[model samples]
Target: MPTIYLSPSLQPFNKYLTTGDEQYWMNLIADDMVPLLEQNGITVKRNTPGTTLGQAIRESNAGNYDLHLALHSNAGPVNLAGKLRGPDVYYYPYSSAGKRAAEIIADNLRKIYPDPDLVSTVATTKLAEITKTSAPAVLVEIAYHDNPQDEAWIRNNIPLIAQNLAMSVCEYLGQNCAL
Candidate 1:
């Protein structure tokens, strides 16, 4: 059986930000993906509190996981308090599989976010989650939390967001899923 790593973002402890803890959104995203993956006959090994995103992918790599997906919401220096929007799919640089998976996800997200241009791009050259994973890896920043509209969408469409992501993965792997 093929395994997939589901990693949600940990709480951000930055002092200047005023927003809900990100873990709640992460967990919701993880929960949303699990049933869909299971429905497609893909086994999921979720990352827990004790593990960093990179560690989870590495450990899963040592096992049987074919893919590693990290779920997150973005907040940027310019878009500080619910002001910026759009989803960004991040892939490990130089990995064909990672790029393919990101493109699939970007296509899926575009359907849901018809107004904005959803982008699939390479991660920052130094991010460990993309740089250190042995298996193909993609991290999805679903939307910019600093944008009120995006936050509202994140809050209201958790299931849709999760479903879109899972569908993309299944599509990339050519698995038939019921929903």
Candidate 2:
């Protein structure tokens, strides 16, 4: 079976606009995705909560996994906080596989997000989640948690978002198992 390193955000300090923190919500999504992945023939190696970002990266690096998927919710910079919205799936600029994963994830996200045009694949050189992992990686910022509308969307649609993401992960693994 294909294995993936599922690294949800470790940042509890990043709070959502309404009721939860990024760590809490991202983990909730990861929680929902695990069973779907397993049923589809994918093995999941997930990061432990309360661990540091460095630790999560090291755990993922130590594994012989096919992909590293980092789950997160966005929060814009000070001036733009509560303003920006949408999902940004980030991949390492030069890693074709990473880019492909990002595209697949973003494409599926677009189908469920209110503003399809806002979902995008971003190539980056800075984020350690994608750059430092051993496997081809894509870090998905599911939506802007700081934005009211986006926060409400996340709060209300956890199951739908989880299902969509699990489907994307399955597609990335070449499993595409409809379970």
On TM-score, the candidate that comes out on top is: 2
Candidate 1 ranges with C-alpha deviation above 4 Å? 12-19, 78-81
RMSD of 1: 2.5
> lDDT scores for all predictions?
0.77, 0.92
Q: lDDT at 139 for candidate 2?
A: 96
TM-score per model over all chains: 0.88, 0.98
Global CA lDDT computed for model 1: 0.77
Model 1: residue 129 alpha-carbon error in angstroms: 0.9
**TM-score for model 1?**
0.88
Q: For residues 1-179, could you state the per-residue lDDT of candidate 1 as single tens digits?
A: 66787878865542213456567777888987899899789998887765765577667677666888888888877535656568888887688998899888888898898465645465555666677777788888888776667777888898998898888889888888778
Question: Please, what are the lDDT tens digits per residue for candidate 2 over residues 1-179?
Answer: 79999998999999886787999999999999999899888999999688998999999999999999999999899999888999999999999999989999999999999999999999999999989998999999999999999999988898899899899988888885976
